[model samples]
Target: MSTRQYGTFVVIGSGSGIGNHVAYTFAVKGFSHIIPLARNDWTYNRVCFFNAARIVLGGLLESVETIEENFETTNIALYIVAQWAIPRLRALSASSAAAKSSLLVTNSLLYANPIPQLFSLSLVKAAQCSLVMSLAKTFNSSGIHIALVTVGGAVAPEKLESKKYC
Candidate 1:
């Protein structure tokens, strides 16, 4: 089947991981109007207990604030992108009643299999799942397709130093 069957897509979190692969695959399959959301790199650095503990112990309130800002950025930015992209997706649907434009999210297995130390990520992913589902239900008749690609056992890229989660 041709990827262009969907016309176009809004791929939030396309900067890396499954989102990147999805965007590239769509492009390869003749999708020319894929919109990839660009997020700040600072959001990539998630907080750990070691860092959080150190900050609390050392009275590093600035570091704690930075972490909070990053967490908020990571959590809210996707929704913001989706809010903007949905209208465009709806417009695409209006242009071609047969072709449904998609909002594809890159979710992680952590949504179901929670990691104790990464509790925040788990919570965020769960919330994201809910958001996608709500959008899907709300816009099903509008020809806007909401889809989730849940990634599991995805390893770090070869260039990056791998750290054991345990």
Candidate 2:
């Protein structure tokens, strides 16, 4: 699809890992305006595709500071951006027949299958999942599509050389 069809694509936490790959994928798909913002830089002038997929590695033995950090990056940040984007997305849906405004959050299965070593990550992810579900229930009928993309394992940049044919 053309950029005019997709509008602007904004990717939060695009510094590395899954978020970075998402931004690159959208660019390759001709999204045109792909706004890649750091974890702290959620502010954006334009409203469009919002991908909130920030992650932090934290362990159970870690201090409370680490747990709080995990929550801030994964759950709180997504909530803050959703509050700002939802209305704008709804507006776009109302204005254009073709426009399908969506808020996509990257999630993980660790929320359900918790690991002791990554307990903080698991807790925050569970909260994030709940938030996304609530958002979807409240906004899906209104044309603002809220979705959670759950990754089952650790996320890393794909190596092109590792490609194997089945």
Give TM-scores for every candidate, taking all chains together and pairing residue i with residue i: 0.53, 0.65
Candidate 2 lowest-lDDT run of ten: 40-49
State model 1's lDDT.
Answer: 0.58
Error of 1 at 85 (Å): 0.7
lDDT of 1 by residue, 1-166 (tens): 2425556777887666777677656755566567777575523222110001111122223344544544465446766767787787777677653544777776777668966555555555677778778877987578777777676854344423232221
lDDT of 2 by residue, 1-166 (tens): 2223355788877655777677666665567677777643333222344344435555678788888877888888888888888988888777656666788887889879988777888888888889989999999998777888777887554442243222
The best candidate by lDDT is: 2
Q: What is the Cα-based TM-score of model 2?
A: 0.65
- Which segments of candidate 1 are over 4 A away from where they belong? 1-67, 159-166
Identify the leading candidate in terms of TM-score.
2
Candidate 1 clash pair list: none
Looking at model 1, residue 121 earns an lDDT score of 56
